[model samples]
Target: MATLLHIDSSVFPGEASSTRSVADAFRATWEERHPQGTVIYRDLAAHPVPHITADAWSAGYAAAAERTPAQSAAFALRVELMEELERADAVLIGAPMYNFSIPSTLKAWLDNVLLLGRTAGETPSVEGTPTVVVASRGGSYTPGTPREGYEFVQNYLEAVLGGTMGLDVDFIVPELTMAGRNPALSALVPLYEASRERAFGEAVGRAKELAERFAA
Candidate 1:
């Protein structure tokens, strides 16, 4: 059976989070299609992974047998994270924009898994792995927008997750998510609702397509 690694890095919960809902849509459809498959979930906001330390960095490159006690403990999480990624057939990430970038918790998790020989350095261990990222932004950053180049969540993830790590990434973005809620963005409420609907629709379609494509 195929395995999926579902990760949520949103600080907000429920209706307050667009990314979470989009990812949830994907998970729901995927689970229904593959009832026997396994889905491993990690809520980064609930249980954040620690940032990689100097000792952990050193230990990552060192031989397993050469690691000191401190290094061993520090690098243990990396081992677990790596194993999870390596074992998964697909990876789904719900990463909401935080100040135009991915949440620090997701970044910390990347640091733990994107190692020299484990994830990317030596020919990308998870190359061609289908990874979907539901990236939601409170403000618009599409073409012709004043802050076009300012969008970094999808760009950065595509570069690192696809360009560097060699994962086959597909992004579903819902922009202007705070339109109706945030007073400053109230004028864009109509656009926000439309984008939300389109995003969720695409999320379900893409998830089902992927699940069926990889189902055994």
Candidate 2:
């Protein structure tokens, strides 16, 4: 059976956040499709990874394959997270576009996982697996639209996750377009509700499909 890691970085849970909802839905469907598969979830909100400090950076860049006692202790935390990523056959990330970008917690996790000679190296590995990013935002950021200026989040993520890491990436962004107008907020309540449901359902479907194809 294959192993899957689900990473959720949303601060909010039940309401006012679409990231968690989509992630939960996807997990449920994935479990149903692969009954024997192993699924591990890491909630960044409950246990946030510490940001890279000066000492951590210094140790990481050092040539010591065998680190000092202090460096060994510091690098332990990062190694734990990277091990989880390496063990998984596939990964699912649920992030909300906070202030037109990904949350700092998720960014920190990325920094820890994408280490030199670990996740990537001088020669890229041909065996690198696939990753799916389920993104949620309050505004629209699709291309060729007036609000497309907000599209920096998706582009930046794709470049880092796909281009740099050499992983196949699939993204799903369901926009609640009518929520901006104060007067329309109330009128568009039903639309926002329906959009969330649809987006979550679609994410679940796509995640299951990918899991079956790759994990099989």
Candidate 3:
């Protein structure tokens, strides 16, 4: 059976997070498509991976037999994370914008899985693997928007997931997510609703498209 690596990095739980909810929708569709598929789920907010450390960093370059005890301990986690990414047929990530960028927990997960010679090199092990990202944000960051220049989440992920890691990535963005609750964004509520609906549609369509592609 195919395997999916599903990751969510929202600090908020369940449907409270736009990215998580949209990602959930996509994952639900994907699971329906492959009823017996294996899914490796990681809730980064609740169980954040460790930040890359010197021991872990050094261990990647050292031969297994030469690794020190400290290096072995730290590198074990990175190995597990990397193995998950390598084994997945597809990857789904909920990377909501936080301060114009991705959450620290997500960053940590990336760091753990991104070893230069393995997952981030010229020919990454997971190269061409399909990956979907739900990139929800509080405000609009599309081109021509007031905060367009401030956009970092997509740009950063594109560079990391696509550029460095060589994964085939598609993004489903739900913008202006704070419009419902924030008084300052009240006027944009309609647009936010539209965006949210569009995101869900895209998630479902994309999930089906990718799932079918894999089945063929």
Return the top candidate by TM-score.
3
Please give the RMSD to the true structure for each candidate, in Å: 1.0, 2.7, 0.7
For each candidate in turn, the TM-score is 0.97, 0.86, 0.98
Worst 10 residues of 2 by lDDT: 118-127
Point out the worst 10-residue segment of candidate 3 by lDDT.
207-216
Which candidate model has the greater TM-score, 2 or 3?
3
Clashing residue pairs, candidate 1?
Answer: none
Residue 92 in candidate 3, Cα distance off native in Å: 0.3
Candidate 2: lDDT of 2? 76
Q: Which portions of model 1 miss their true places by more than 4 Å?
A: none
Candidate whose lDDT is highest: 3
TM-score, structure 1 vs. true: 0.97
> 123 in model 1: Cα distance from truth in Å?
1.5
**lDDT, candidate 3, 159-216, per-residue tens:** 9999999999999999999999999999999999999999999999999998998775
After best superposition, candidate 3 residue 86: deviation in angstroms? 0.5
